[model samples]
Target: MESYDFIVVGGGSAGCVVASRLTEDPDVSVCLLEAGGTDSSPLIHTPVGAVAMMPTKINNWGFETVPQPGLNGRNGYQPRGKTLGGSSSINAMMYARGHRYDYDLWESLGNKGWSYNECLPYFKKAENNEVHHNQFHGQGGPLNVADLRSPSDLLERYLQACESIGVPRNHDVNGAEQVGAMPTQVTQLNGERCSAAKAYLTPSLTRPNLTVITRATTHKVLFEDKKAVGVEYGLKGQRFQIKCTKEVILSAGAFGSPQLLMLSGIGAKENLDVHGIPQIHDLPGVGENLQDHIDLVHSYRSSSKRDTFGVSMQMVVEMSKAVPQWITRRSGKMSSNFAEGIGFLCSESDVQVPDLEFVFVVAVVDDHARKIHASHGFSSHVTLLRPKSIGTVKLNSADPYDAPRIDPAFFSHPEDMEIMIKGWKKQRQMLESNAFDDVRGETFYPVDETDDKAIEQDIRNRADTQYHPVGTCKMGTPDDKFAVVDSDLKVYGMSGLRVVDASIMPTLVGGNTNAPTIMIAEKVVDSIKQQYALLKQTKTASCEPS
Candidate 1:
């Protein structure tokens, strides 16, 4: 029976920003509902605790893709954030805004006011970069971004190897260029993880206009005459309904948002009928055009004494020693981002833009969740920047509690496989480069150097998702049958409902999705503010002297 001016569903990266921004107006009451518990776990706060969260279900949705034909019918594991801050709290914390061309593509696809120039301000608005303060970065913003302090000496050599391989060294990936190997900047504040909850929600929780309810699973959006009026959700074991007087915003990320929309009978008619849900709207794009980045990790042991993998125990001791220094001076090993560095390279020499991207991790990551070797090692993960393959997401059953079916269909396109192969070959070349001549050790993979078939088979067996999902509910012109939302992010055939999460992206951004999702929320918040202000002015003028 409770009612509010606005109801925002899901407290992930985008929802947190939306709820926080909407509640800025003292008169506008806002309610935020999250399916997971509070982000109070120590793993959620520590910078290096992401590894622990990967296997646990406490803060993850733990959904798996249906058998994918692209990878020899293997089901890919997809872990999504289920907690208050969502995946931002569990992610590797790499702060990437994606290529400027990515946003320009959105503008070209009929998305007005979504060009790189127009969206850059929002990116700046959300960031409090501790490194630089020029046009690309802001001084004081909600999200804190800073450089990693404890990079391994081997990582520095990896960067040099990239340069030696004709890849330029980028000073700032978020700046003018995103096409070079650079140390990753992370979302951290004073060595602690800075999730969306920490950046936006924590500060706004005490506001009287804001109410945050966790462990509340939203069942569906209540609609009257095709307009969203409220939501029905349950917390713990109790069920309740809350009305939205103004709007219902869905920020349930790429998977959850689309699943909620479909459950509410707002998706494709055929799908709704199959799931035994009555169709309210026949929008077909609710769960189509699924996209994600597939990553292949290459691990190598180090012969050089400087490799961090060999010195992990020493590094731990060093970190312990440096923690006191960090507490006193706010600098040292405690400030490292763990993903020490990254690189962007072109798989095809003639290609103008970088087609392959690389991330260098200080730890040895072999299996999905298992790192067997105790020796010193580093991981070079290569991902195709632009994948040609498209996939889909659907409901497994009519029940709202059932997890939706997801199919990433990675490497469906032959070009994607080829690109990955080229990237893998490049990884080997980098390891053999003179920069690593003294430091290079044994290759964990491709144990039989002479078996070409084994190398290809190893790639298929080892590939895993990079966890960046998008384009399930894409933005496009109405004529585009699969387009769920218009360029302005307004859902088709809906009066007061909008989706402002990663689901609105027409395609996946080239890098980490956290920054891009936050940017979308920032842009949508401005749009909502302008519309609400205009409505208020109109009502006030009409009431005066009438």
Candidate 2:
């Protein structure tokens, strides 16, 4: 029967930060519980090792979407992190803050204090930009953000092609503008991945006020009347309960958090009744409004002999020689974030914001692994951003171990498919451009682009998720029935309970989500501190003069 000032569940991206920040005060005690184990794998630390962890359950939740009619009823694989750092530990490491308009939309929807200008400081506070120290970037923060250590020649040509196509080169996408070709900044520190667990939890583990317990699966939130007082969880086949004197924060990510909420009788009433659980709060938005990015890869067999695929032996020798150089000097191919080059563009000229994101990889990625062909190979992955389609996440049964029902309904909007088709055409034209004339070879996908309908069908058949799932429990004003949390991230109708993960996003950000999730955590920490301080002052005033 242990009790604490605060109990944070799911020690992933947001939970780690909440627990660490809450424990900063000497009088407050905090406990963080995580179902996953430590983030100690070599694959998690190495920048290039993400390729190996994609299809495996080693550090992933390996869930799949229900049959998506837009993709001809084919199920799509959805991978999430199941380790200490969560998905941030196993992601591509791109550091994108999304467009300013994204946050303005939240404020427009009655969520105050969420404008781009207000949220920008949180993004800066969570990052330790290695390159510059300006109003937009912090110098000595915990999370490391830096330029690509290894720049490939093919990527340089790709950037040139973008320039030739009227798109300007942006030195920093996270700066004033985000509508150009640029080398993506990554969350890495001296070539190692800098996950949230690494940045926040690792250093705070030794704090006397903080206690971190891994391998603890939270079953449900304990409520008396309507107030969340504690949690019920299990560890090593033993069930346990812990009371919370202050609050219970859920950071189990987009899927897990919603699933837990539903199991605790806090979701749609119909869903709860069907699952034989008593309805405590009928919040229908707990698992609705799911959104994600769908990507299509166009591979090309290279004509040049200098591609990374053909330089395997040379690469090994280079790595062997560069190891010591890195040990002493810290530079070279070993420091690269694999996704060397990227471009942002709109599908139509009339569109104001960029709708498509292109990632250039030096090696070929067949299924999920980075498979090197006998000849040199390169790939261009076109991702549709800001999709109009939405989906849901539901529990299969009431089992916590069972994977939830994830239906992204990708390409549900006809316009979304049209955009991908246009992206495919744009990719072909870029390949045929003079910038790649010396290195171009045969196209690997949609082998025949002459037929428009065939190209569209091919894209639908081969499309893959970029593994960015968000917006299940959105944040908005009380008028929106589906809105689970308010602008301050407090769960609607529930005291001492809050959500601080990607689940709080009203809409998916325009680009990578890892950095944005971290930014949300940073912002929510300040809100929590302000609220706690106000409570402390009120208590002191009440006791002083009566």
Reference-based lDDT, each prediction: 0.85, 0.84
Q: For residues 139-221, what per-residue lDDT tens digits would candidate 1 score against the true structure? A: 78899998775667777788888888788899898898888888888899877889999999999999999999999999999
Tens-digit per-residue lDDT, 501-545, candidate 2: 999999988888888888898899899888899999999999997
Give the Cα-based TM-score of candidate 1 against the true structure.
0.95
Candidate 2 clashes between residue pairs 3 or more apart in a chain or in different chains: none
lDDT of 1: 0.85
Clashing pairs in 1: 309-376, 310-376
Give the distance in Å from residue 45's predicted Cα in candidate 1 to where it truly belongs. Answer: 1.4
Clashes of 2: 0
Q: What is the lDDT of residue 30 in candidate 2?
A: 91
